[model samples]
Target: MSNRVLKILVPIISIILGLFVGAIVMWMSGYDAINGYIALWHGIFGSSYSIGETIRQISPYILAGLAVAFAFRTGLFNIGVEGQLIVGWFAAAYVGMAFELPAFIHLPLALLAAAAAGALWGLIPGILKATLRVHEVIVTIMMNYIALHTVNALITTVSDGSYKIDRIQKTASLRSEFLSNLTDFSTLHYGILIALLMVVVMWFILEKTRTGYELKAVGFNDHASQYAGMNVNKNIVLSMVISGAFAGLGGAMEALGTFGNISKMGGFTGIGFDGIAVALLGANTPLGVIFGATLFGSLKYGANNMPNAAGVPVEIVSIVIALIIFFVASGYIIRVLLNRMNKKKEAK
Candidate 1:
């Protein structure tokens, strides 16, 4: 099989294995696995509301997935996406609330603010990695904490000690009444459009651009890229900035579309962390990330129905997701099996 075929088959096989194992677990626990899955399907697609909400949940996952996938392609492990996202959320929310302008101007301005904030946050670690030989993983991990506390303080200061900020004005909102009515009044927004656009942007950048070539080359080997006259350090920093911008756009989805406001976070949102699984399941490819995000989004949203509809705990869904991740992580085994099968076929 071609490498492309292998890439597609791996995730498909992983998802099937995960579901199969989950069914076994459900049967062992005295639940009807078939009923559980039936309910899951209903929860994801039974109504217009469900479909809208599922897509709504998927919007941020797409951007977050892009953030991690971009960095991975550029030889960086950006663990700070959560932090960058939080700051972006704040920046977007502040922009939306602090100013009033035409919708065309206000909305794009908020998005740009969010992206810039995230880029700045990412820049710190990128510069450190490029100039000081510091590990991005360590710096990004610590930066998550810094982003959390700092954003919380900023929220308090902005809200005069309140825990939440004001809702965004109409001009800055991504909500569409027409879309809401079409989806039976779900919180659907234009964020999915933005998410889809970024997917294309990522694809174009990595697949068609010279800058992307340098970035990927640097990621493959800094010494080789440097010997070939590429600016390794610049590429590294540029990669992080772009990755951070994607993550920031993710925050904008929440700020302008889902919630329309920023609130104090008592703990991590888990969106960025989930992006890790998304990137892994996607095989770190742009189009692959959308498929991965859809699976995750549908599963997560549908899991809510298991308890009432099938008498199964929602935690089972989590277990299934974990299983899928495990299989994806062990993709080398799958590749080996495929190779053996190909060899046996040749012998015949």
Candidate 2:
């Protein structure tokens, strides 16, 4: 088979294998695996409310996934997306609360603040990596801690000992007028639209822009790119800045649309970490990230209902997601199995 064919087949086979393995594990643990899966499906797609919830949950995943995917295209591992996201969250929230402008100006301004904050956060690691020869992975990890503590401290100061910030102004908040009937007045907002728009924008940027070509070239081979007259260091830094902006936007969506305010001691949420898996599963592409985020969001939303109905732990969702990533990452095993089966058929 051609390499392209193998690439296509491997992930499908790996998913099947992962599901089978997950079923076996669930069965051995004394759970009715079939019922568990049914419950999960029901929770994710059974009703309009469930579907809306799934979309809401995955909205941030899309942006976070895009952030990681963008960085991957530049051959950079962005572990600090969590930190960048936090900073963006706070920056957007603070701006939303501090301002009193019309929605047209207020909303866009808040989002822009988020992007800028995230971009600045990402620039730190990019500069460190480009000029100081520091590894991006290490720098990003450290930046996560700094962002968390810094946000936490800022939140406490703003809240005057309270944990949560005051409700965001109406103009800056994201509301869902279209899905009010489906959500039963749930907090699910219009941020999903923003995320979807970003998916398209990212696709255009990566597929149609010259800067994207430079970024891709650097990712393919930095030494070769430099030899070919590309500004490798600048591209590296620019990639991080763009990636950080995406992550920041993700955070802003969550803050303005979902939470409505920032919280002190705002912990490092796993959304950013989960983005790594999402990007990998999607092969670091815009459309792939959307599909991957949807799958993950469905799993997360469904898992929340499982603990109540199936007497199973919601944490199992994480395990399943991890298994999926593991299988995909080692997809050569699936290719080998397929090759063996084809050879057996020929022999027969």
TM-score of each: 0.98, 0.95
- lDDT string, candidate 2, 1-348, tens digits: 666677667666666766778777788888877888888889998877888788889999999999999999889999988899999999999999988999999999999999999999999999998898799999999999999999888888888888878878989998766675667665678989999999998888878999988899999899999999999889999999999999999999888998989887536888899899888878888988998899888888898877787876776666777788899899777778878888898899
Model 2 pairs in collision: none
Cα-based RMSD of candidate 2: 1.8
* Tens-digit per-residue lDDT, 1-44, candidate 1: 89999999999999999999999999999999999999999999
| Candidate 1 segments exceeding 4 Å error | none
In candidate 2, position 211 carries an lDDT of 90
| lDDT score, candidate 2, position 313 | 75
Per candidate, the number of residue pairs that clash is: 0, 0
> Which pairs, if any, clash in model 1?
none
State the C-alpha lDDT per candidate.
Answer: 0.94, 0.88
Could you tell me the TM-score of candidate 1?
0.98
- Count clashing pairs, candidate 2: 0
Residue 343 error, candidate 1, Å: 1.4
Q: Candidate 1, overall lDDT?
A: 0.94
Q: Lowest summed-lDDT stretch of 10 residues in model 2?
A: 178-187
What does each candidate score in C-alpha RMSD? 1.0, 1.8
